[model samples]
Target chain A: MSELRTAGANPPWDGLDGSDRHAACMVAARDGDRTALDVLVTELTPLVWHVARGNGLDRSTAEDVVQTVWLALLRHLDRLVEPRALVGWLVTTTRREAQRSWRTNRGQVPLSVELTEQLPTEDWLPEDEALRDDRDRRLWTAFSRLNHRCQEILRLTVLAGRAEYRAVAEALSMPRGSIGPTRGRCLSQLRELLNAEGGSR
Target chain B: MNDIDPRDDDRGHEDAAVLTDLGRLVHELDPPPVGLVERIQFAIALEHLDVEVARWERAGSFAGVRGDRPGTITFTVDNLTVMVNFTSTGERHRIDGWLVPAGQHTVEVRVADHNSTTTRADDGGRFVLSDVPAGTTQILVHLVNSQGEPGRTVVTPTIML
Candidate 1:
């Protein structure tokens, strides 16, 4: 068990950083500035995609989910109060849309297979020399083995590292207080899994 | 062995190694294929064009006849329900409708053309166009309506096409 150093309680995510971009986007979008909306969409598409995929939505469905989320954004633009909350709002909306899309379409056919089957096989190859030499395959394998929640939380918070704990907590439905502890625990779990699989060469 | 603190050992070595690897992997993972900004930008431009078209339709009439414009329109355009309180005239127009389909069309106003100034409607009846051009030009419109119907409208620009 690794000792958690409170995972940097401040997290340097203080006031508004990425959320500022979202605010700018909202203002632009509100003034009927499609360019700002385009910028917003371009920057956040990956985040939404990852969110959809992390939520167990298959690729095609996830794509639909992303599209739906954007459409919803257009509808909700006037109702939004804070510009900074866009990230959290989007993530939460995407999750809800993805789940809804999955549930709605799951009965017709399994589209998740399409996305997972289309998974980038090349990622299996460790690109970094340090990670490549000894424990690359094991680490990669362990990553795939991580449960959906862990994968999503890790990717959104640690990988993207764009949103704050409040946003992350709202998006993931975890307790606001538990975000730091859970993040630490999730990282610890990953390390443990890696170590058990002969990590660090 | 009794004095050996496992916590310190784990923190000093294992955690650092894992954190480093996690950081590397996170940065290294390729992002999924995204539509180019240019493509989105194009779509947005089309959307703006739609908004401008909408602006003309309600109270922003170009030739005293509102909602009468035509061009290679986008059928998949979204957010068309715009409520504009025109400062130019102190009037408001709430124009909400689906994208019009392709064909010869007419607009009481003009839509600016800034890109190729021409595009073909997709099978789904959406076209990418630049700003509407100037002068008494005949606008060709092939667009789909909100109900996804193939339709056409032809308009001579009274404002700025």
Candidate 2:
């Protein structure tokens, strides 16, 4: 499917090009083409890894979560309905796995910015601090501290970009119509937390 | 006091910040494990071979099929007494190898993971306890056709005697 190479030389995302190619590879993977699945894993691993770390999972836990996601996909490939929704499915699954890992571990390490450094950074561009200022970090910290229900709600809405009421309902087990108002309330609560922490920063 | 709408266009700057941080964080997140793609693909191919075998077997059409399975292949050496099992279409399922006399003779076998090699057969597939070379342990045979594609699901988990 894919050639063996060093991460420094041939990064996982070297050839994603755009979202369309990403979508194409997903379709090919579902069709049982190893070559296509190779490209799909290579291109999408970054995003899945990111989602795991972003959700407060530590490096090792996040790594396990990622591997489990791939293995789970191996066993459940035939269950995927819409090929185009592969990204959404992967994102949702990664988040769930990451959360589960962190929760099960309980008192070990918490998710922090350090989790982001587990991978090499040769391909990464510098971050703009104006964008990732103290406020952002605080929001992330608060996000990490949120109750599981709110965390899941915000995750489905703000993070993975799933706007369909039905999908959000399915993911969070809320009524289909409750998604909009619930999302608004969650964001407002997040804003309150962000604003309260602003003075100290 | 001031208020900001999370979804307003003017907050493109804030959105840009979140995206930038998220992108950087994502970029730094570890890639999938090394050799993962190959391992997964190998597994998927193996699964497909199994499905194909089950279908053929169910349809009663796998009588003489050969080289459709993916795995290491094992067989007797240099024994024309080898009986060939044929599919209804009359094809050989197991390839014949020339059984050589004792001491140390190489019996050719194919490994399903895209590798091929030979093992020493004491008296063909007869010697119950012959020691194979260190690197030439028992091979789980899955014969591929001339095109090098998996052909049949013969004996799975086959070990060279």
Candidate 3:
């Protein structure tokens, strides 16, 4: 922990990077540093957003889930045993909250129809309109081609960055060892799709 | 066969580059809703860290035929239930709120990027905040324990007004 903290007098709190930074920020936040808490919220919100979106939640619902997860963190700040595991804790909480919201939205559907509804559909994402550039459109088109698991894994791993593989793996319930290979295969498959489209064009 | 595949190293490097590019593209395409972080920060900016956040019960929007009626929403946690009705008058808005187990309490309406309005609920558990600027808002009910000390605060999720 001392190593994670900055050295020398008047050292800025922003010295650490990656998970170490998160842990340091968490420690500072617990010690009543509002600035550290703000940094944590700004830095981690995107990862939390992707986690919620990856769970197939609509925009509004995902937004609510993201807020709820952060509120939960604020409430449980002292109870979090390992500040270093903050990403994993947040990812897992987001998934749970997203699933809860998803269930609430689908509560009216009959049990028999619910299973079918659970299957990934080809509905247009709200973000589709934002993909204006031809390159972005093409990449999204290929991204949409992958299976639900592949899409989820790729989206989360990429958004969380390479340093957060352990957190992503644990949150997704996938073996830690499999994330790298699976991500590799998924990227390769995406490239193949992109190449095929390029050829056709 | 050797445990190491020569292509593995190169593929890993290539995958890293592609993933990085894809991450950028993904962000460009599907960024979180604008101001979401700031809104969350504003909502959680509580003076007391130990507080109870009321669960969102239900919200209903009623568009008046002539655009006159008010929209109502409610939140609950444990024994406390807070219900607020929103009515628009010109550009500003009015929030009339009621708390269950009716009693006197401090009611604060927190508006994002704006100074929060704090008012006291009457003995009947009624409070009103008038001329509120339109933006994201949240309600906080400050409770007093039987001993008349500062009890746990109950906060509602961010609501659009």
- Candidate 3 residues B42-152, lDDT tens each? 878888777777756432222211234566776777899998888887666898989988878899888887888999888888999887877788888999765657777
Better of 1 and 3 by lDDT: 3
lDDT of 1 by residue, A17-124 (tens): 455546866876787766567667766777777777666654544554565566556656777887667877888787666655544444433334334333433233
Model 1 agreement with the true structure over B1-161: per-residue lDDT tens digits: 11111123336466546555654565465354444333323323333232211212212212222233432221122333211111121222222112343332222222333322444444433333333333322233434464767553322112212
Q: Which whole-number lDDT from 0 to 100 does residue B10 have in model 2? A: 45
Model 2, range A34-69, lDDT digits (tens) per residue? 566666666556556556655655444454456556
By lDDT, rank the candidates, best first: 3, 1, 2
Local error of candidate 1 at residue B77 (angstroms)? 15
Off by over 4 Å in 3: A1-12, A106-118, A127-138, A145-150, A162-201, B1-21, B57-70, B101-103, B122-125, B145-149
Off by over 4 Å in 2: A1-23, A50-56, A95-143, A148-179, A199-201, B1-161
Between prediction 1 and prediction 3, the one with superior TM-score is: 3
Of candidate 1 chain A, the 10-residue stretch with the lowest lDDT total is A1-10
Candidate 3 local lDDT, residue B50: 77
- Candidate of highest TM-score: 3
- Cα displacement (angstroms), candidate 2, residue B130, comes to 20
Q: TM-score ranking from best to worst? A: 3, 1, 2
